[model samples]
Target: MVSETVSVSVPGNVDLAGDLEVPPSSRGVVLFAHGSGSSRHSPRNRAVAEALRRNGWGTLLMDLLTEDEERSDALSGQFRFDIELLGERTAIAVDWLAKHPSTSGLPVHVFGASTGAAAALVAAAERPDRVVSVVSRGGRPDLAGGAVGRVRVPVLLLVGGRDEHVLDLNRKAAEELPETHRVQVVPGASHLFEEPGALEQVAAAARDWFLQSAGSGPG
Candidate 1:
């Protein structure tokens, strides 16, 4: 496998920092969209990315915000909830992946966490031809608003059984998703899935979902 830090240039001359890792023979690439106030360096996301890599899938963990923007957001917490902007950036990253030498020909998948789930949906809606599937880990996909109904790809919404409110939200969001979508609850886990073995279950579920939905055509 090969891993490197990359800078993805988006609109407005913005560059998002990322860590891209591709296995010797990858089935596809999974782009990770972190949740509220998180970045590519998030430990949870890094753990998940490692799991995907072990399964022969490439992974890209990126910070959707610029360093300066992130600094500003740290105080106001404004940009984290800007779903529209986040989605736009995610879509732009998809375009960057298409041109990158390593991931150009691979099928693209999105793994979203928390609010990032909504951004993933919007990205899928915006670039149906590029994204093959989406997976939300304790995500607020409802935040994607109308974009939820527009995503044609198979989506897997993973929620913690103990997180009643978020689970309910996921159920509602699942209804608007394509027929191939589903909501899988990880019993005993909370929002963070910090309990022993909880994160492993999440990684397993995501790996299985990506493998199963890979053959499905574009969203």
Candidate 2:
């Protein structure tokens, strides 16, 4: 059964911002970090949430950008380019989720799309105990640069075959990551995987990775 979605406002840079989703008696909680101007309302991330909830895993799809930041980006397009700020916001949300009653004891995983992937990796590096693993889809993980090496969590990088640019970036990021992680390029898909059946493969691959890495509670 799916637990109701609740607003667990996190103290962001300014006023609090964030939302958490928990599945009933969930095996674990996966936090979603939306990139650029996206927020908790992103359809793609929401779709992934539905899939994860069905698979018995809870989801916390938080917005990396606040309302003001979103407006600023709409005007100047700067938020997506600032990985550090995005990473900081992601870290704060993860910390909040760690303390949220509904998610406190569960394994925490961060699933990032686009630039949020870099932020997720940085958070994993910063809070190893809170974030046990990471999964990236159509992500610009390379944007995280040298931070990948510092992450203790096992990371699974997923890129679409047709998205050559992002695929190459993930390939390079994989080399920087520890040998324990895995990287896969889903066949017959683009960055958005708008193509039929492509996104399904990515979702399945990520689910397996998150479940495998979710140990018996936090380390």
Candidate 3:
């Protein structure tokens, strides 16, 4: 069950756009922090979200950028690289989910792709008490700057084999993270991992990691 029509509006602030799906036996909720020029409508992220839902996990796919911000960033490409802005917006989404009636009180996980991965780490670092775990798919975790060291939650950074550059970056980022986290390199996959069964592996790795870290201390 994918709730394509479902979304969230924060009111006073520009309402964040998203697709929410809650499974009957959802163990926790995973929120998506899309990378540059992307939104909840991203087919790749949506595919992984749906896979998560099938495993009895709830999912929140949200666009961290506002319409105006998104438009400006598309042209300037500045906002996307500004880790602080993306991190703040990602944190807002986490806070909203934690307080919402449908998803309130549930443990939270942030799934970040590409640049979004770094944003997720920043959000997790800022709100360790609320966010339980993190999963980065072909993420640029290093872009989060020094925040990676302060992240208390267990982080799983997934990288593609063919994407050597990202894989190297993720490896380097893992060194900065505390010993509680890990970096998983998937073979035969690249940045987007559009090859057959590659994204599914990313989703599965993320699912297992999130499930393991759900209630664990500092995970």
- Leading candidate by TM-score: 1
117-200: candidate 2 lDDT, tens digit per residue: 999998887887788889998898888867788888888888888889888889888888873687788888888877887767
Clash pairs (backbone) in predicted model 2: none
RMSD of each: 0.9, 2.0, 2.0
Q: Model 2 lDDT vs. the true structure?
A: 0.80
Instruction: Give model 3's TM-score versus the native structure.
Output: 0.93
TM-score, per-candidate, Cα-based: 0.97, 0.92, 0.93
Q: Rank order by TM-score, top first?
A: 1, 3, 2
- Give stretches of model 3 more than 4 Å off: 1-12, 217-219
- In terms of lDDT, the best-performing candidate is 1
Tens digits of per-residue lDDT, candidate 1, 1-219, equal 678999988878888999999998899999999998889998988999999899999999999998889899999998989999999999988888898989999999999999999999999999999999999999999999999989989899999989999999999989998658989999999998898998899999999999998888675
With candidate 3 superimposed using the best TM-score fit, by how many Å does residue 147's alpha carbon deviate from the native? 0.9
Model 2 residue-pair collision total: 0
For each candidate in the order shown, give its overall lDDT on alpha carbons.
0.92, 0.80, 0.86
Segments in model 2 whose C-alpha atoms lie over 4 Å from true places: 1-13, 216-219
